[model samples]
Target chain A: MTIKILGTGCPKCKQTVDIVNKAVAKLGADIKVEKVEDIIKIMEYNVISTPVVVVDESVKIKGRVPTMSEITALIQAS
Target chain B: MFDWLIYFSDWLIYDVSGLSEGSRLGTALSFFVYDVIKILILLFLISFIMGIVNVYFPVEKLRNYLNSRKLYGLEYLFSAIFGAITPFCSCSSVPLFIGFVQGGIPLGVTFSFLITSPLVNEIALALFLGMFGWKVTLIYAITGILLGTFGGFILGKLDLKDWLTDWVKDIMAKTYEKGDTVTADSINFIKELPLISREAWHIVKGVLLYIIIGIGIGAAMHGYVPENFFEQYLGGGQWWTVPAAVIIAVPMYANAAAIVPVIQVLVVKGVPLGTAIAFMMSTVGLSLPEATLLKKVMTFKLISVFFLVVTVFIVASGYLFNLVL
Candidate 1:
């Protein structure tokens, strides 16, 4: 499974990556987490805001930064 | 509440420190403790409320609508309001600026969003409320919005398409217009509570240091920095102070978060409210980095014009505030 974090590497976007990565580690899953910074690529997912999280090709969250608990839960279900 | 705080300060200074309450050390300590507790609490509440409010604005949907439509009179107003919620800085704002232009939104509306988003920010509001109270904060916000709206309206009216870089102008010609109806997901506030709290917490943490430093500086200046540090500009109602403040701030640029404390210190150290506000608006509105980023899309002529217009507006706002407040 793959997780995509969308943002142009703002401070909050960086925090989102760290949270998602830590969640993946705790689950002991070999899932790959990627940073999708390109605006066109992000818009392709129909996302309007930065720091969006995409799990397995489905749009999950956007705009606001998610906490560790929220990230772990979103990823675990995926 | 203030009485309680006053009593607490007196007790701490007289009973704990054995220092006379009239001493400078006593006053500084009291001011420091009272301000820190009060401001931090205010910051927490305001952030929480703003977080709750932010959930209602479907920004992507709003942007999608702005991109697709050709709003004439209302465009500037909507764009200015939307700018308040956009989560972007100068660098990150570039991609979105490109997207807006490519989507066929007018250059002026885009400029409105770009200008007000950073100028009248939540962080700035929170800090200002913590330090200067709501009345001054309200005036600052109103001026910021007006600047965005009015500046954008005039710029858009000029229709300076030729001033934009060739690539941006080319993108403006592209016809990838989406439909008008924006089917945003129905929002549920209860479900968003967790995110709201987390967002508020992050905001509180982000500016915790600024508040500490701001209050620290205010505390130090409370009894230290000579009361008449700015005396030369006071007695005669220094009419030139506002413009002078803007000139000083233009070269030494900083964001609201970093400079707000400095602004607080300036006000505490005898600078007029109008002068302080003018300096702040200059910092936010005409920063060198923002100008550089805008230069990507704007010509030298338009860029220089934008700065010139915004500076005049800021200086005017300062003088107006001095006259009224």
Candidate 2:
């Protein structure tokens, strides 16, 4: 499964990346994490703020950072 | 109404039954505790609500819509208003500015958006309401919006595209090479209650320290600063205080959330509302750090012009408020 994290490299976005990466590592799941920073790309999802996570093709989160537990649950759901 | 808060804080911070309860230290402790709670609650509640609202207004769509607008004034106004929701620090804002300029939105509209980002944000609004009440927040927000709208329109009319970095200016030159919009893996916000809660939690964690420190400073100042020290000198009647406030604040770097309480102290100590707000806006809107960071995407001339315009208006705003409010 592909996990997309949307951010503009702001501090919150960076934190989300770290947590999501850790969650992916701990789960030992075959998942791809993509960081979307381009404005043209991020807005296509109708996201105004950064640090959003997308599980597969669905936007699971936007605008706030998620904890490792939340990240794991999101990955499992998708 | 807040006596219980003060008393509770006094009991916690010092000898509650002692004569020192009426002393400066005691008063400062009480003020700090009362204000800290009030500000944090306001910050958390308002930030959560704003986060929810932001989901509805993505920046990319806003840019495309602005590009399509033939009405320059309306476009600028809309862009300026968008600043209220586009929650990016100055560092991230430059990228968005580049995106808007390349996306065929007018430079003025993009500039308005950039300028408004610091001025009309939830942080600033919450702090203003927490310190000075709704009236000042409304005025400050309106002034910020007007500054962005008018400043951008005039700059747009000047056609200063060449002032941007050659690369950024060339993006405008290559305007017709627009890329097709990409679709995202999307989920409905309504079904994402957990995500929403996480978002709120994140905001509270991010800002809690700033709120405490700011309130702490305000409380201490209210309690300990010598009486008539600020009011006698920096008070509303001082002709030069407003301008000086802006000048002093322009170099410091702090978000609106962290600095509001300090500004509150300044106002309470007899500094005029206009001067205090001018300091707030200048510090948040025209910091040296922000200017230094923007150098990556903008040319010296454009940066100078941007700074000059924002500073002049902010200083003027301070004086106007002092005179009228």
Top model number, TM-score: 1
Clashes of 1: 0
Tell me the lDDT of model 1 at B78: 87
Q: Candidate 2: lDDT of B176?
A: 54
Error of 2 at B210 (Å): 2.5
TM-score of each: 0.84, 0.83
Q: What is the C-alpha lDDT profile of model 1 across B1-325, one tens digit per residue?
A: 3568767867877789898867878877877777666666666776677666667755556677776677767888889888875544555566567767666677888878877877887677767886788898998888888888988888778778888777666656767555223225677878888777778778778777766776776666655677657655552467777888898788655435656766787776677788888888787677888777667778899888778777888888888877887
* TM-scores computed on chain B for all candidates: 0.84, 0.88
Error of 1 at B173 (Å): 3.6
Which portions of model 2 miss their true places by more than 4 Å?
A: A1-9, A29-78, B1-27, B175-189, B236-239
TM-score for chain B in model 2: 0.88
> Each model's interface RMSD (Å)?
3.8, 5.6
Q: Each candidate's lDDT (Cα)? A: 0.74, 0.75
